[model samples]
Target chain A: MPSHDRRLIGAALVLLCGVAAADTVYVTLEKDDAIAVIDGATGIRTRTARIGKRPRGIALAKDGKNLYVAASDSDAIQVIDAGTLNVTGTLPAGKDPETFAMDPDDRFLYVSNEDDGRVTVIDIAARKAVKEIPVGIEPEGIAVSPDGRWVVSTSETTNMAHWIDRAKLEVVDNTLVDPRPRAATFTADSRQLWVSSEIAGTVTVIDTETRQPLKTISFKIAGVTPEKVQPVGIRIDPARRYAYVALGPANRVAVVDAQKLEVKDYLLVGQRVWNLEFSPDFGRLYTTNGLSNDVSIIDLASHKVTKSVAVGSHPWGVAVRP
Target chain B: MTPALALKLLIRFNRLSACAGRILLSSGIVALALFQAAALGGPAPVRRQTPAPVAAPQAVERLTLAYLGQLAEAAAVRPYFEPVVADRGVQGARLGLVDDNTTGRFTRQEFALAETRLAPGDDAEAAFKRLVADGRRFILVDLKPEVLRRLAALPQAHDVLLLDVSSRDDALRGGDCASNVLHLLPSRAMRADALSQYLAKKKWTRWFLAVGPAPEDRLFADALKRSAKRFGMKIVAEKTWTHSFDDRKTPESEVPVFTQGSDYDLVLVADEAGSFGDILSYRTWLPRPVAGTQGLVPSAWHHTLEAWGAIQLQNRFRQQAGRWMTEADYGAWLAVRAIGEAATRTRSLEFEAIRSYLLSDGFALAGFKGVPLSFRRWDGQLRQPVLLVQERSLVAVAPVEGFAHPKNELDSLGYDEPETSCRAKP
Candidate 1:
């Protein structure tokens, strides 16, 4: 065996003993009603913290002290302490808090209230739902631009992304997308927005400057049919070279050339991959697979699925701590 | 009032409960905006911001849809079912209009539904002509088979797109199929085939068919028979429900004795009106699962469907109609959304352009069935997944995993192009 493989085994042992401080990957177990914590160093699930019912949409605080989880069935955004993996508090997120985008400064939690066709903005510090902004019908995927200038809510039925102006606190523009858009994200520089449409089997990238769609990238896998390639979670590399899209049920993560806006490769992963998160150094990508109840770890450099660590039932969203 | 405006009124009055969705997200704003909306005691008003306009704004293109249905349906209504809804077909169309208008709000296009309900014995042709005369090109007919057939026969309606939202006439998809008519909901044959496909995957080959006495029950039974034959299943024994005793009071002997002779893996009931199928679950002679109209049923939409962005439609319908969305409502909603999707994509106001776009291979509408549903060119029936739901939970979705088709997997659940007798031009 290579020395690299032996070093990985040694790191796995240290993680099994639960004694080291390394990059930690947090996964929301949508079915089992818990959050699975895995050591990024070893790619082994070290802990499963029972949280709330049908937890999804996880995010780590920039300070790395708090982890926010959208406990959808419970209808509350549950905050857990990163150090102890224990739920710290529940934020009043308004009915059915499914997917949420936190402010870069951690001031507000913009959650998509699916049943209401509105976005409920919860004040993180106050633990109260401060504002309810109506968007298109069946709003699901939500995003806050890195620069905090805009909040875009992707409505599934309306098939449009509502651009909410931060200062105005109302929808300033709407970018029409493909049907049943499931996920969305803003580029690190907040210059572009990428949305994945599950039903249309395509990813739409919008130029944030004009709030207009720049390109619509449709996926066509060799053996897999079009309908099966339902795009869900989208994550652009910090280096801005590649944008990874989680193809739900197709069990593949499509890697697109972010600069060129074209699908370059498809990396096979576990079943029903729903969401993706990057490791601290941007060296690895962790994905939560809903059907297989596991998280696939992909080495960014090699662009390969390196490991599949079994987590709780129906792992949905993934977050990482440095 | 436009459905879009009505929906806004509902949101202003209704405080919707937050629910969960399994998907992806980030940003936050100051608490000042909440204070602004808090004064209204409701959610902030959703302003439909039209795209950056021209110096002289072009007139908004308005598309009006006509809904035709009877105030009272002649079909048998179960005395024991949920309270009779006043707005069944129209409500669904109204919600569909709301969604279409929401999308249209950005494109400078406005969609409206002009709903018309006839009194008993009202002339169907008069209403159809009036709607067309009023410049309504997209008409959703929720009327009975005879009324619909009458409208389809008119020369004035030949060029117009007439949508069948509530009718379940299998023959309409066959000899009576119209060139301009399109179907949104699943027919009896499709529903039966959906149930049979799930049962086939489970290897449940024997079905003891207990058909009720209603004329509609017989029709449903015929579909069940065709589906059973198609799926290679056998009706080990068949019996007509002959009991006249009140099912609610006398649960002791009727179903058990009626179902006694058949030794089968499943007892399939064809009770269209909910006359006696509700009691057949535990009352069957043998310990077998029951399915068909009551015990476990196949439907296009249900309240419990949260996956594939269905909850969004269910929520919007509930908010607008103040009730659960039914099969009729879903069909009506799909019909309008279909027209809206075509119009939005093709950016055309003309009937031929939208209709031709709908018939083309490029058109597909996301109806929250976990798949993009499209109309079949041969029969004009919407190809969609059927939900096998037991009262409280979604049991399964059909076109089960292994079921395959040359064109699409959903085609396995209904009459394929080759099997359809729709002789109208494609």
Candidate 2:
């Protein structure tokens, strides 16, 4: 074979791989009733899809072919096609669907109906609610375990984290946490669950096996008062090495060493930061700032906020395509 | 004494004795009936005759609260300043009852508010006795200090929990403190201190103090003086305004003259009524900012506040009342919400249970403020964030960034435990 032909084949293979690895970031602009898509490499918004009224929570499908958003005011889950960025269908959800979590296999979606005090379980393919499990009052945070065996819903007013058995669709245990729990996340190993309490200014860690609180991590900055250090949205890295917590009025993200369970640093971000997401390689973190109406991107290696990109009014939820 | 007066006094004493005797008898009968039911494992006849259904609905617990106030004439202010409703306190209590019921529907609890408005010169003591006689244990009082003290001292009010939602006099929480009374309104000192904190943070240390002629204005001025000292501010000059100005007559010519001979960073007015304070803002002698009762006033609730889910509450109140919420309304609402929170947490509507739960350390009510509001153990005053608001916008919130306390930061805006003169009776 000719050497020029071999070089041309190598170039073609590299182009194909680059196209396959293309990434896009989706953010829910809560007040604008739209979801913005940003090009991952350039950090520029490429497209926006108007989904529904008060779009709050966003999650991508396992295959990265579709996006699901919890439209709180509309009380439905809007399904969007990733390729065209258009609303393809709507799934029946409970009253005031605020936040949700999808199973690892993308077969089922668990939603928190804040006003009705119930968790609606939906079959993704059928686009209908399968079961309504009653939880505590003002349920806002919803999470499913990595092993797809358990689901947790945190209620704001009732101050309880209810653990639901996935297969049975029943509440198996209830763990009381600090006041006004807003968000929850499960560790990669499925051994521990972390819930953030906005009014209590703490993150409660619970053991999945025993279903008991293992530790409570409180955040305190040198110049900020304790009441202002509200923990709202939390994200644990894929490797489970670090936990990033968005402190709502403090305008800072707390970096917690997950292994040691200690707060190592506070990265200054935009005002009223609430939700957080990470890049596919865990090299960058994105936080949605509700008050400042922007998103802050932080470089994971240096622990610094690299840039702040302006979005719509009250950006709340974010999802990244892998 | 004259024979006729002596005879009248004797008749009144006999009537009082008869009323007390009747109350004692009714309470004794209720206690006996409760004991009989408990002893028989239920109310005897029904339980013995038929077995109740396994899925019988549980008896819903009902919480009754009362709002008592005197129907005094509205303040003689300009027509533009007229309130939408003459009965502000009762409206707040009614809205609070609705909010409680909204949460209660899910908790198997119900709440009802009983409103009683007295005519001018009517006997508040008699009206309060009537409410207690009707078995209302929680009462929200919007009466004057003297009337409230009289009601609080009545023997029939010993078991009742009174929430004062209108009076801002510190004396009620200090020298005249009552064992059964809890204060929801921010005291004069708290408001003054809140303003002083914001002013100090802005570095507006020099103040020109202007006071009105009324006694309430004098009291407010005294509170401002104390706050200035506490916050390390200096009063550069002082004056007393003895003139009155109407809307038709502008203060453009006289205000500058009245505020002359002062080099100050800001002007602090102590006008309790809406007399001349509004005229001092842009008409100050010096090109300075104005604060206190006129310009940047400190209040418990303002329409400008839209944070911490307050917009939802404001919208609800507007829909129900068809007007903006006032400070008195917010105070009354907070009082009722405190009771609702206590009942929901303990799952019991018993008076003693709710009272003890409210006084416990675990009791904190989210009052749409940024932080959880709890009563100060020293004086039974609700500790909360005070907002510094202009006419159209929220300027800032109190307990400003650098103002720290050993315990809660809200303590910085009011009397601390050490400084509190209230020897609260247990």
Candidate 3:
């Protein structure tokens, strides 16, 4: 059926949508405990696959064959076959997996066990937890460098990012940031890391080489209240030129000049935008609006919210791939 | 969210500047340095030599904050639905130490909260002296307004920093306000104002006010009346309850009769004791929403508040305390974090430096309420957004849209600069 569905999707790509633009947008509905699959070409939700308890983080595989979701309450990573949209397998993620990052080789996934105050490194092929790294409490934002040399875990209560050396699997350094750091993202070359502090309304750009913060960028939208400006999910583009940040509750995605280290523009999205993902071509950005219960598709070319696809309740995390 | 559970990361601390030699930090009597380290039983922080570019460590400074609270004399009867949590407010102060230590790990600072709860007939003056002698100037207090006033008047408490965590008496922030103490929890007036804003937003302008027999209930009712007037809401029907309707017995019949004559958009019950608010919620004759002490209550913390990074604190508190964090606990937590923020922002251990920085306009505490909570220079009241919550869901956060002030929107909640008689500053 998986192979049959892949052939149908391939046929649909050629018959309806173009090959390069046939990106499948998968959004995890936190409240609904389901993944809403949308056809990127039309910005329309095609399927709703019921997966796991409290599904938040959704990551697409390298070959675009599987989608791994962090089912927090289930304490397991539910893997879904991309073609069939069926849960194929499970990976042992520790208690309450908030989010995770896949290594460059896609061999491992560093999952943040929020309640456990540890990051469980899962071996994809083995389907087992390989190592547990003790971090600060309420560890939320997790990232693995594209080179697979470093893994960064940002702890909310600790207000520090514990830098894990990929080789040694040991925490070598810690950088203090603003209070309640929610999410962290590394640039394409993995030279720079952007961390969003939810409470402080600021994002600290860390220098990956020196393991130090380069600049603390504070956000202030003209009409938005300062308290409402909470930065959560951050993602840099394929070109690594512009970084997009989901400002929680403010309902705006901040466009940051990654090279220049400045907030270029703010694309107004939906209420309580938690996480976002860039499409295969990086031509569009999909934001999971938690409160709005919708997926806002941002046309990257125009930097405007082009379409809002209602994906049911609490759309938390989004991922797209060809 | 929380500190690490120490696993092989044993951080050996060289107390660079130990202020107190021998001090009873806790009832268990922990070593001054290991107070917070052992209390949380979280991983001992491992400090690296490489310093971060921004907010780097100045030097390893040992600081201690103390908790001063009074045990409730009479066992307060909570309705059958509520679970009784002992050591409620103190747990919040304890969590604050854990939180401070989280930042303390990177800041090269160690923090401890000396807990002292006054039981029946305990000497407040002697306990205050002991904390002061132990170099514990910053104390988070959850006491009655009168008890707080008595402690602040003590000669030894002159230079000490006392944070009022629980007392919601507006008079304490007004005439009875002390320059030494900073109010972390919002006053009754502020809570009423927070609720009024939400009511105004919803156009629930007509209120059926129900007041319990308790003295605190009356005070809360007073606040509700004031807020109603301020928000341009009409108290169409006001009633005082003197009837002793046992919660075990059928209040269904009694409550409807009591509320039958009233026609209002919302039922505002000011019952400080969990006396009859629950009984009034669904049993109201009009089937209108009940707010205030029971239904959609305005509070510092709620079990349902998972937004604006509050989930981190909620998760941490549940993991550590094995219970939900209460409003009193949230107040205590904020006081401790305020101390840490003040200390970290100024980067000094000097009493005046920390105290002034706390009161200064520059000092802002990220209270996980989607805002930077700061002290009102006029009344020493911590300005913060109030949470309006129901049983299992967060309804709204107050200082609701369009409820604005020329200076600070949070100032619009409680007594403003001109409205207050407390002149903390010249």
Best candidate (score: TM-score) = 1
Candidate 2 structure quality by residue, lDDT tens digits, B1-426 = 433343233221101112222333344334333333333243333112222111233555677788887644333444444543565777677767765654554345677777777655677888889889999999999898888988888899899999998888888888888889999989999999999998888899999999988778898999999999999999999898886555555588788888889689999999988688888877877787788988999999999997775765677678778898888889999898889878877888999999988888778677778887888878888889999999899999987878888778999977888888888652
Q: Cα RMSD for candidate 1?
A: 7.7
DockQ of candidate 3, scored on C-alphas against the true complex (2 decimals): 0.21
Q: Which lDDT tens digits does candidate 1 get at residues B1-426?
A: 433343333321111111111000001112223323432332333432223212233456867778887643335544544555656787888777767776765565677667777655667788889888888788998887777877887888876888999877788887788887898988889899999989998999899998989888998999999999999999999989876666574766677878896589999999887777888888888899999998789998888898866776777778778899988899999998999888888877778889998989778799888888988898989889999998699999987888877668888876787888889853
- lDDT order of candidates, best first? 1, 2, 3
> On residues B1-426, what C-alpha lDDT tens digit does candidate 3 reach at each position?
111222112132212111221221221122223323322332332322222233332455777778877655542454445555556788787778776765665556668767777664666677778878988888788877888888888888888888998888988888888889888888899999999999999999999999988899999999999999999999999899875656765787788888888589989999887778888877889888899998999997898887656877887788778999988899998888888777766767678888988887667687777777888888888899888988888899888989877666888897998888885541
Pick by TM-score: 1 or 2, better one: 1
lDDT of 3 at A17: 46
Clashing residue pairs for model 2: none
Top model by DockQ, which number?
Answer: 1
Candidate 1 regions exceeding 4 Å error are A1-21, A126-130, B1-56, B71-77, B243-251
Q: Tens digit of lDDT per residue, candidate 1, span A203-298?
A: 999988667789999998887767788999998987789999999988999999999999999999999888999887777889888888889998
What fraction of the native alpha-carbon contacts across the interface, defined at 8 angstroms, is recovered by model 2?
A: 0.04
Off by over 4 Å in 2: A1-56, A61-139, A142-178, A184-195, A202-225, A236-245, A250-272, A281-286, A289-315, B1-59, B78-83, B102-106, B243-250
TM-score of chain B taken alone, candidate 1 = 0.85
Best by lDDT: 1
Could you tell me which residue pairs clash in candidate 3? A137-B2, A156-B1, A157-B1, B4-B43, B5-B43, B6-B42, B6-B43
TM-score of candidate 1 relative to the true fold: 0.87
The regions of model 3 sitting more than 4 angstroms off are: A1-20, B1-60, B75-84, B243-262, B276-289, B309-312, B345-348, B360-366, B390-393, B401-412
